[model samples]
Target: MTGVPKILMTLGAIIFVVGFLMQFIHIGRLPGDIIVKKGNTTVYFPIVTSILVSIILSAIFYFLGKFR
Candidate 1:
């Protein structure tokens, strides 16, 4: 049907927009050191590292998808 192409295009456009937004969603960012000290115990939270990992992974996915 003639409507099929139009429907598919619309869905593709929606997927593009959603994927674009996802590129900006910071899954990990620090407000501050993610731990506190009451004079004992030391801990750490990995936020910046995760952001970097996400970026690398996204880039790889983007390129692989393109080459296909």
Candidate 2:
């Protein structure tokens, strides 16, 4: 019923927030590429990672809802 959809929305929001936070809890930059130490080394790609994850999750939710 209506209650079920509300619960789904709430749960989806929580899942999204938790996933988003995972990218920031690290010791380095919030996401993006970063240079470490005095040497020349750059770690990249995580900045777009969070968005990609969120999009994938949302797509999954959307497809699942198509049957409901």
Candidate 3:
């Protein structure tokens, strides 16, 4: 019960910080990300960013599980 709220608060704070940093960081433009542009059209995909985030989250959860 108490742990639930603590976990929620920590997650919320992490999300907030990530969101704030994203405003100034070009995370979507990292290497291995895809970008297509035509005269008046553009498409973007953050492949590397997705993988990096996935790896980070997986590690975080793995360690948390280990501790528990």
- Model number with the top lDDT: 3
Error of 3 at 58 (Å): 0.6
Ranking by lDDT: 3, 1, 2
Best by TM-score: 3
| Candidate 1, superposed: residue stretches over 4 Å from native | 1-40
Higher-TM-score candidate among 2 and 3? Answer: 3
Q: Write the per-residue lDDT of candidate 2 for residues 1-68, one digit (tens) a residue.
A: 87999999999998898779878865334555343554575545455556766797899889989988
Alpha-carbon lDDT, every model: 0.74, 0.71, 0.91
Badly placed stretches (over 4 Å) of model 3 are 1-4, 23-25
Decide which is better by lDDT, 2 or 3: 3
Q: Show pairs that collide, candidate 2.
A: none
TM-score of 3: 0.75
Candidate 1 on 1-68: residue-level lDDT in tens? 99999979988996897689779985444654266556687567766766766898799779979998
Instruction: TM-score each candidate.
Output: 0.41, 0.37, 0.75
Each model's backbone clash number: 0, 0, 0
The positional error of residue 31 in candidate 1, measured at the CA in angstroms, is 12
Weakest lDDT window of 10 consecutive positions for candidate 2? 27-36
- The lowest-lDDT stretch of 10 consecutive residues in candidate 3 is 22-31
